[model samples]
Target chain A: MPVAIGLEGSANKLGVGIILHPPHQTADPPSPHDSAHSDDEAFSTRTQKHTSPPVQILANLRHTYNSPPGTGFLPKDTAAHHRRWVVRLVKQAMKQAKVQLEDIDCICYTKGPGMGAPLGSVAIAARTLSQLWEKPLVGVNHCVGHIEMGRAITGADNPVVLYVSGGNTQVIAYSAQRYRIFGEALDIAVGNCLDRFARVLNIPNDPAPGYNIEQLAKKGKVLLELPYAVKGMDVSFSGILARVEEMARKLETSQTSGGGPWKDDESGQPITKEDLCFTLQETVYAMLVEITERAMAHVGASQVLVVGGVGCNERLQQMMGMMAAERGGSVFATDERFCIDNGIMIAHAGLIAWRMGFRTPLEESTFTQRFRTDEVLINWRD
Target chain B: MAQPPPQQPLRTLPPPFNTSAESFELIAQGAESLLYRTTFLSPAQPAALKVRPQKTWRHPTLDKRLTRQRVLAEARVLVKLSGEGIVAGGGGRKVKDPKKKNDGGGDNGGVGALRGLVPAVLALDWERGWLVTEWIDGVTVKLGIYQRDLAADEGVLRGLLGRIGRVVGLLHLAGVVHGDLTTSNMMLRPTRTPGTNADAMARAEEERGEVEVEGGLEGDIVLIDFGLATQSVSDEDRAVDLYVLERAFGSTHPKEEGQFDEVLKAYGESMGKPGKVVLRRLEDVRMRGRKKSMLG
Candidate 1:
């Protein structure tokens, strides 16, 4: 039997997975995330109150922006980051699996649904490694990987995947034998809006800016009516972005010396940081819940799986849980490993595909940054 | 279940000069002609035979000229489009007409033999007015399960488009237009590496690259059926050719066609030198196509 290692380097995340099952194997869940870490020494222990089932964190690492902030990391720079981190990450993952290098069978990687520059960089590296090692590689859809990882961790085989990320925010349903994109952002993502608003607010791209913003929204008291817009399955955040800018600019201008509205009180029923945080949290999470409810009604699927960096929001999860319960369906939320970026999902999804005989030839080892989940034919099924 | 073939007493003539063993089994009866499948029991040899009905050509003088030109055109186009004939199936160069002079016109079999197009073998009148050519072994591009079965096989699609773009470039360079460029016309050939067998073991001692590259690749791609094609010097025609290919791409293969950029990218790369003028006009052609679709 051939041991297959999967490599995923579509964007900044460099991932590799190994699958041992054969194409002839009977139907079973691939890489079920129902086990605790094979070894616990490699991680820093952090305990939480909720006892979610221990996920099989089969070796994973995330290397964020080596390049300085301000400007987005160019494609070449991102690829360089991948080339440096991939080998090391894979080695660490193997150590956790306690498997030798060659024991790795096929390598699976993300081909696209990302930037072309980043995609090309990963492509060259993957193609070269596969050629030298003579390993069959499988290119996977990044979005699909997110969805699959969400399912693997949550055990939701057919939940509507709501992917909310820095670049993408969409309410997707599996229909017509493909991922029919039911709703999406008209312009920027909810994350992008938050990041830009944070830029205006001088908020860093910290892991929990959403959580931090939620904190500040608590202080805000004045009923600052902001734009709330949602069209059909699609949602618009430009209005939200514009509304925040207007409030900020208004506050700044009024306090600039002359007899302005702010000059009288310096702060009129001043919107506290908590209120802003609460309002932002309420607004965004409400929008998410609204769209998710709409998607459940649309797909007739009561269960919803929220997967992405944004899925970590407590308010978002709470609302989705409330919505799911109201509809008499379950809401699946991935643990931190599946929520924040990690190689585990790639490994999880890749292993499933490898078991299903989705192998790649050497000539096609290029990375695809923008692979649509709907484009790939599902190889694994319930 | 037991329907008999045509009643024409068109003798059991095998398409000649093909390395195949079995005779040509006559097929499809056209008002003006007929088609045939040339079968060879030998695994190594492959070919096809096409035959037209008798007295289909009313005018001897004009029919002779047109058929002669069409056959010559197909052969000429194949020469330029097919690389030193490396990856292409060796086309049938005009051989001696074996039909009796009193029997009249030669077989009009060479209409689709252009660029080692994959469809037929021995595409010419071996005895009289018959077209025969090499038979290809592959599935239709539409049926290629590589993408579905193998995840990283998107490159195979790109390579196919690259082959298409390169061939289209060749035809355009020679001022030829393949009026139809659809999924059915494309075949996915297996890339054969050195295989070891007793016969292959015996042949291993034989040389490499064998200056004689006759029976090797079938030229990676066999674009079949150029019967509705034409050779011209107009940019309009060249753009139309691409339009046909692009449209066929969208309609025939919807799921896989999402990678249409690969085709255009490859086309942009291969059509580098001669594609300058026509490439510029391609924009206009696309614009006009969009306008026409909207209005119509």
Candidate 2:
């Protein structure tokens, strides 16, 4: 078995995880229709014919930098938070994993497509550890990490992937050894739109802005009119975001002036803040689901695997499940542990690449702020 | 909370069509709509019918809004495009001008020369969510290019690509943007027969030889599926349309990807000045794929 320790601080969250991959086994082709088996069983059986064993998460831990209400985390503060927590988190992860320095095969860290400062902090930490421990360094793509981890956890073989997070929104499918993007958000990401909207409402970002929005949306009964902008397979949310923010400002102004509450046209009832949240969520999620369905039809794939931070929302999952079931397929999702950004995914995905003889030299270990998901060559997959 | 019904959940025709004795031949099933081949008006007139079924998965109100909006949008774009005329070339039968009576007698020379380049809208009921258009007889540009003899000369293929570009330029010139552009959406309609009388002509063409080789890089490029199209004169919209087609063509026809520039070349020449600006904007659009990569 090869053990790898992954350090992830691409954004506000600082995560350190240790993973071990068992030795290769005899090849066993998994049936695509087989979902009766447990996740672990399915994980073990489904591979690209290399018979790669199921991943073992030795340790996974995270510490998020939560900004105050109505404020988003700044890159500088988030980077400082990661810098302060990186060493401690790595030490704790190693101790929790109960592995010695000599037992580690390699060190992994997120390479690109993230906040520059945070990515640099993690890379510096990974580089320092690699030099101290005399282990090779494996650079992993942040998006690819989420995808591989979702596949490992759910065992959804060759399904279309809808990766939604604060930074990214793409509908991807595997083809010709690359995860080709079929559709995506043309402007700001779906999560970013939700987060900014939450800020306008001064929603607490305790667990997450998106999470709070989902909760408030549960009580909202009226679906307010919002601009529906879906062009072909691509969607634009900046327009919708601007419109919602304007509505929020108007609502605030009316309340401060002691004007009558914004009443529902039919019910003649006051529209609460929850109604705005509900409308935003419904409109955006519907756009996401529609594009996802279009991709499914284009590629003729039945199964769908949703990953990233926004994947944790119950309503989004429920909506996706309905769409998948309509196509005679099911949705595969993980809990917050794996759904949100974390280190284990990086470790798991990196180790797979490392085993395939892929390594990032120190000279090429530099990170980028604009690395695309499709740029990564998934040679390990068929 | 509850799951939606599974795929192929007993689809039913909408309204008056459901009561008609005429048989509806299922042509294609897209994500948002089902396409059927059915006769309309007269027994001999063949038409392409697009039905946007109600998605039970969506909220009832949202579903109704989308169905009505899309159906109406498509009908409006088609009607507008059909009104503008392009120079009809090649050996195809002349497009029967619907506005001929409105023009008051004799040919207004080249007026509506490109009338048949897009199928004329026969009828549509937005509330019921279905559209019918005069059927164009022939194969899709996708299959036409796919069936080409690889060993044959590339000249004919390039010519076909140039024509595709020219037609797209004309579409943009008409102040419309085809939201989804792919070889699949462009049809290689046989030009020799009467365009309206598609039923008998299609059969006659098929009997001549393999439909693919019989035309062999010959025919007018007729655009179809206006479900996602919009009325926009912006260069950004036009460039994006070309970009979508470029990406789709690359993925679908990797072998002929290098020749896609022929389409753009023709597009630029056909649309004159505006087309050149759109082509410039296409470079920026290409730099940013579907979305620009930012913070993780």
Candidate 3:
């Protein structure tokens, strides 16, 4: 078995995981160290056959750096937080997996499309481990990590991936070795919009702003009107964010002036924070579902795999389920353990690449802030 | 949440359509609408019926709102483009050739140049999410390109590409954007004498062979499937519209992709000054990869 350890600190979350890929019975073992192009065809053929043993997650642990209510985490502070805890998390993860330093075959880390400073910190940790342990390194695209992990956990083969996170929102489907983007957010991401709205509303960041909003929204009955912008398959959320922020401000002022709560125009019923949360989720999730459905229709795909932080929202999952069912398909999603930013996905995705003779030399082991999902050649899939 | 029991088979003809379902033939079922081939009033006059089906997943109110808005938007654009001289008899304009009145003359007395280039709207029932238009009798550019092997002849391909560009240019010049600009959305409607269907049909078949060689590319380039069309004149919007078509051409007809430049050249000539700016903006859009960076 080849084991790989992954470290992730793309944002406020810092995760460390250990994964093992069991050896195939009939096939020759993959080269222990990086073997260049000779093994490429054979590796791809093996993957295409789907003959590799099921991946085993030996250990997956995370520590989040939460900001105070009404505030968001900054890159500088988040980087410092990751630097302070990366070593401890890694050691703990290794111990929990009952694996020794010699047992690890590779060290993987998130390579980018995230906060610059945090991504840099995690890359440094990965580099240090690789040099110290004399193991090869594998850099993973954060979004691909999510998609691959989602597929592994849900057993969704060749699904249209709806990857939603604070930094990115995209609807992707695989074609000719690339996870081509079908649609995406044209402005701020859906998760970013919700997180920003949560700040304006002074929502707690204990669990997560998005999670808090989802809870509050459940109690909300009024479906307040908000700007809905769906352009072709893409969506724009900045307008909706601006409109909701203004509404929040008005509600705050009304309460401060002792003028009573804001009332609905037609019903004269007082509006509450819950109502705003409900409206935001309803409108945005609806947009997400619509775009996903469009991509599915265009590609003639039946299965959809929702991944990333926003994928954890029950309401989103429910809405997606409804849409998929209408098309006589089904939706696949994972719990926050895998959906939210995590190291296990990085380990799993990186191991797949490593198995296919991929490696990141120590000198070239670095992270980027603008890596695109489609930039990674998905050789593991058909 | 419990999944709604399996979707009921889609209604063949909901409400208003039920009365005339027997006369209509389903031609295509698009993502948002169902297109039926039928006649308008008389059996000789063919028409297309587009119905926006209600989506069960969407809230009834929202579904109704979107259906009504799209139906009206498409109708409005068609009506505006027709009146502007993009379509023959669109503005009720007289043809330049008095002798060819029954032939549906290709020339309209200068509304904005390209005449008979769009389908004329005959009627609309917004409440029922249906609209009827004069049926275009011809093949789609996609099929025409495939069946004729348009790429085999450089001159013929260029002419066809130029016509596509000119028609789209006029559309943008008239302040409308066909949101989805795939080759399949356009039809190559052959010209004909108004009353001689049989003669026109025979001539069209003969012309198809000649079209493969002579490079005359003679026909009206009629745009269809206005389901996603919008009224927008902004240079950015127009550039994106053209970009969409450019991508569609590359994907659908990779062999002929290099000839798309003729389309842009013709588009530039037809659009004049604004076209120059839009073409320049298109470069920027292409360089930026048509989509904004995913990272915040």
Candidate 4:
């Protein structure tokens, strides 16, 4: 068995996790969550023969850096927050795992495709730990970590993946040892649009902007028109974000000026903030689902997996389920524990790479901020 | 004793044209529609019937709205282009014909013709969500290129590529942008003689395992599948259109990627000055891969 400790601070969230990969054992009962495809005989047979040992999560913990309402987390502040918490989180995680120092095999950390400061903070912590524990270091791509973790948790074999987050929105499929991106947001990412819109409404970031928007959307019924821009499988959200922000400004001015409730032109009902949230979610999620469906049809894939932070939205999952069900397929998703940025996914993906004889020298363990998902060679898969 | 015949499964189409099932043969299926080959007006004239099935997953109102909008958009673009080409070629417009020698009659020097470059829209019904157009008989540019032998002479392939660029230039000149410009969306119809059907060509290529270089790459490029087309004259939109085709070509035919500049050269020559501006904008689009960098 090989045990790896993964550290991640690619964004406002700082996570620490320890994983144990037990040797392959025959007749090991399939995980209960593996019900995603229990009815598909072909998928079961195709996946069973080459399935790697199911990963064992020893300890996974995360701490988010929450800025005040109307403000986003800055790189400098977020880096300081991660630096302050990384040591404590690692110590707590190791203690929770109850594993001796010698039992650990390697240390893994997110290397790139994130904020420069936060990634650097986590990389430094990982380096110190690796030197102190005298373990090898594995650098992981943050996107690949999310993907591998989603697959391990959901057991979706050969699925077209829709990855949506604050910095990225991509429709991906595995082909020829690479996670090829078929289409993506042509401007701002779907999550970035939601977060900015939340700021416009002065919504608190206690949990997450997207989660707060989802809550507000649930109370909303009026479907105000928002610009829907989708080109082939690719989507654009900057236009929608601009229009919503303007609407928010107008709504605030009317309320602050002591005017009567802003009545909708046709319904005579008061236009509320919830309606804006509702419209934004509906339009953007539809675009995401549409692009994902296009990718599925293009690749002739029946299975789809949703991963990344925004993947935690229940509405997105529901809409994706509806789309997938129409094609005689189903959607697989994990809860916020795995969907949100986490260290376990980094540890899991890194460990798999480690098993394949990949290593990062001390001189080459630097982090970057602009790595693409397709840059990583997925050698672990066929 | 009398014996009864077994019942065959019937695939019913959407209303108004569902009575004749024998004439409709499913040809291709896309994300939003199903395409069928059928006869229109006269039995001998083949036509393509594109039926946009109602998406059950979406709200019924939204589904109907989208289907109607898309069907009308495609029909409008096709109709406009189809008319522009004939006006330039047939009536007193003295635009030099690329394929045939023109007997000069009247001067309409500035007009761009799309004749024989796009399928004519024979009929359409936006409410029922179907559009009928003249059927194009040929293999797609993707298959034509794929079927060509790797060791064959590159001149024919280059000529085909140039024609594709010129045709796209004419489309842009007519103020239309093909949002999705992949090789699979373009058909190579043999001049004067109808070539093999796209499906039959694939089967023949697979069986023969050889490229027939004599006439493999000669045809008039006909653009099809206008579901995502839009009427836009902006250089940015034209550049994006070209960018889409460029990326599609690189990914689909990596072997012939080096020769893609032939497309741009011909496009620039056809459009004169405006095409150069679009090509310049293309450099910017290529740097970002159709997306701009955002704050992390």
Q: DockQ-based ranking, best first?
A: 2, 3, 4, 1
Q: Which ten residues in a row have the lowest lDDT in candidate 4 chain B?
A: B1-10
Ranking by TM-score: 2, 4, 3, 1
DockQ of each candidate, alpha-carbon based: 0.01, 0.30, 0.21, 0.19
lDDT of 1 at B172: 56
Clashing pairs in 2: B86-B113, B86-B114, B88-B113, B92-B191
Displacement of residue A331 (Cα, Å) in model 3 is 2.0
Q: Model 3, A148: alpha-carbon shift in Å?
A: 1.6
- The Cα error of candidate 2 at residue B104, in Å, is 25
Error of 2 at B246 (Å): 2.9
The TM-scores, one per candidate, come to 0.51, 0.87, 0.82, 0.85
- What are the iRMS values of all candidates? 26.0, 5.5, 6.2, 9.3
By DockQ, the better pick of 1 and 4 is: 4
**TM-score, chain B, each candidate:** 0.57, 0.79, 0.77, 0.78
Which residues of candidate 1, in runs, are more than 4 Å off? A1-25, A28-56, A66-72, A208-211, A218-223, A254-268, A272-274, B1-296
* Native interface contacts retained, candidate 1: 0.00
lDDT (tens digit, per residue) of candidate 1 on B163-258: 566556645554556655555455555542233121231243234332212222122445654534555557766766676567545534556667
lDDT comparing candidate 4 with the true structure = 0.78
lDDT of 2: 0.79
lDDT of 1 at B292: 20
